[model samples]
Target chain A: MTRRIFGVRTLGLLGLGLLLVGSYFGLFVAPAERYMGQVQRIMYVHVPCAWIAMVCYTAAFVFAVIGLWNGKPRWDARTTGAIEVGAVLNALLLVQGSIWARATWGVWWDWDVRLTTSLVMLLLFAGVLALRSFVDDSDRRATWTAVATIVAFVDVPLVYFCVRWWRSLHQTQSTPETVSPAMVLPLRLNAIAILLIAIWLIAQRAKLERERLRKEQVDEPARVTAGLEVTDA
Target chain B: MSQERKRRRLLAVVALLIAGGVMAYLAFGGIGENLVYYWSPTELREAGPRAFGASVRLGGLVEPGSIDRQADGLTMRFAVTDGEASVPVVAETVPPAMFREGIGVVVEGTMLRDGHFQTQRLMVKHDNQYRAPEDFKPEDMKELMKSLQFEETGT
Candidate 1:
């Protein structure tokens, strides 16, 4: 089992390396934005966190579907892992945006549609995680988490598209085509670095979840009579 | 087992129906009526009397040379333009440091019958396009460093 999961260590090392280089490029190598000047460097961390947070939620959504379909504890564990990391990144994204907003928008917060939906998205998923803790039975907990995750995942797309679909103070998405190559380089580097880091976090979190599931099965022998003891674990 | 399967199918169908209903609602008129975050100067102008004295957030670029700082220092007047149309604005508060001519901005306030939008909240709107200053001069950097050093040593 340790051998199987050892790949994540490599992921962590590479992610850290890229993050350092990417931050250097964003902060020093890349020129300050014409209008925003030094303040625009916040994009290096903010955009990646926003992207990876959505990516993690989308992963959780996929794992959730599989968990519900197969009623498998492995999928449930993976779903939880993605959701937990996603929520942390989502929270970080909000903080980064607030700091940026204070510098650029003059307000730390606003009730604009994009901002509002992102907040709601965080609440919905955080609520799902809260719901998971209240249930004790592993099977029931897995089912409820999967179900709640599917519901919460609905807000992810809304948060991403609201800026484009509506008139928003938050600018629309910045693609490689829209931005200069100098700016895009750091942004892309940070994006890939954050994605790899997110994957490693999910893997570690899921392993912990699987171990707890194994313990539960061992402690409650009668519950394991159905031969549904996690085969991977 | 067949009874259990039947119940599951029914639940699935109900969920799908709810999802479809939501999609329909969003498609019909929801985006236009409910989801508008802010209106541009053009839209606000077209709104006409409907816009009068009603609270709204108007978004647009600040027209160059339109800013007029009142004698009282608490009031500022400017024209917010969307290229095609412009809306005169009187803001009763300080604009953000980033606020400048040609920068996009959003102001929340009420529109008066006399065509001036009165605002207490002015927010700078930034674009996604990031570029280093093309016309940045080397002399400016030297001057900036001198200024920084002057501030630090207090000489």
Candidate 2:
């Protein structure tokens, strides 16, 4: 137990340190964009959040598949954790994108293909969370959650590729050829930092879920016995 | 407890207003009209009369020296060009912060009967490229490395 706690503590500290360093470099050390001016600095946090959000969803997808294949309670807990964390980041990504859009694109929001697909992705995952809550039976909930997650995974790839496949007002993905190496450093640092933080959060959330499952197991027999007593009386 | 509940209610109202206001300001009109995102000058030219008076986003570079801000200030005219074709535009809205000649832009409006694209919303489109204004070339990085090496040797 102490070892597990230590792991989380270490992850949080390391992630915090890297995030501070990355933001410092992004805000001050890195060169401000030419046409975009200082507003482009938002990309450091925004892109990382977007990338990690998708990473969380992808992990959730893999875990859901595993849970479905083997009907494991642990896999269900992990899938739940990943989806919840992914949704939070996805919401943050939209807000950050909106702010960047207002600064650079001259609008708070636009229904461009990429932007629309990302919003749909958030909704689809949020639906999975809601579905999990409505169902009372644990095994049935796990099965349904797994199926819903796999269906939602379809939108993740679309969000990433829509800008390339369609005529979007949002620009295509930036690359080393397009962005300066100096700009790339802080962006990469922030991505790693945020990813570490996400892993820590998912671990904690999954642990909580497992503990809840254990508590429910301990209560199941007593509740059933009480129901029988009332029926007999 | 009553005060806490009242505050919660007030917070909910404020949050709703902020979200609705933002959506109304930016999205209500601008979003659905831009489903196609943008049409190039070539496409607009090909569409011809079919494009007239229909809502569309005409996108291309703002041709250098084509900007004409009427003395009235509210009325500005510019030409959008995609090399092979060019479309003259008269915009009522102020250009975006980064808007300038030679920059890519998407203007939402309609093709007028008078052979001009009349736009109410003018937006700038930035490329996926980013660069420092000071132009830090790769040679500068090599020079920095060489200077660092010299310092190490002297130490």
**Candidate whose DockQ is highest:** 1
- Assess candidate 2 and give its lDDT: 0.78
TM per candidate? 0.87, 0.82
Over 4 Å off, model 1: B1-30, B71-73, B135-155
Candidate 2 segments whose C-alpha is farther than 4 A from its true place:
A222-233, B1-35, B136-155
Query: i-RMS, every candidate?
Result: 11.7, 17.1
Tens-place lDDT per residue, model 1, B1-155, is 35533543454345445545654555454554565656778888889899997889987778879999999988999998776689999999877778887777889999999889999998887766666788443333233222212111111
Enumerate residue pairs that collide in model 1: none
Look at candidate 1 and tell me the lDDT of residue A174: 79
lDDT of each: 0.79, 0.78
RMSD vs true structure, all candidates: 8.7, 14.3
Task: Find the candidate with the highest TM-score and give its number.
Answer: 1
- lDDT for A98 in candidate 2 is 94
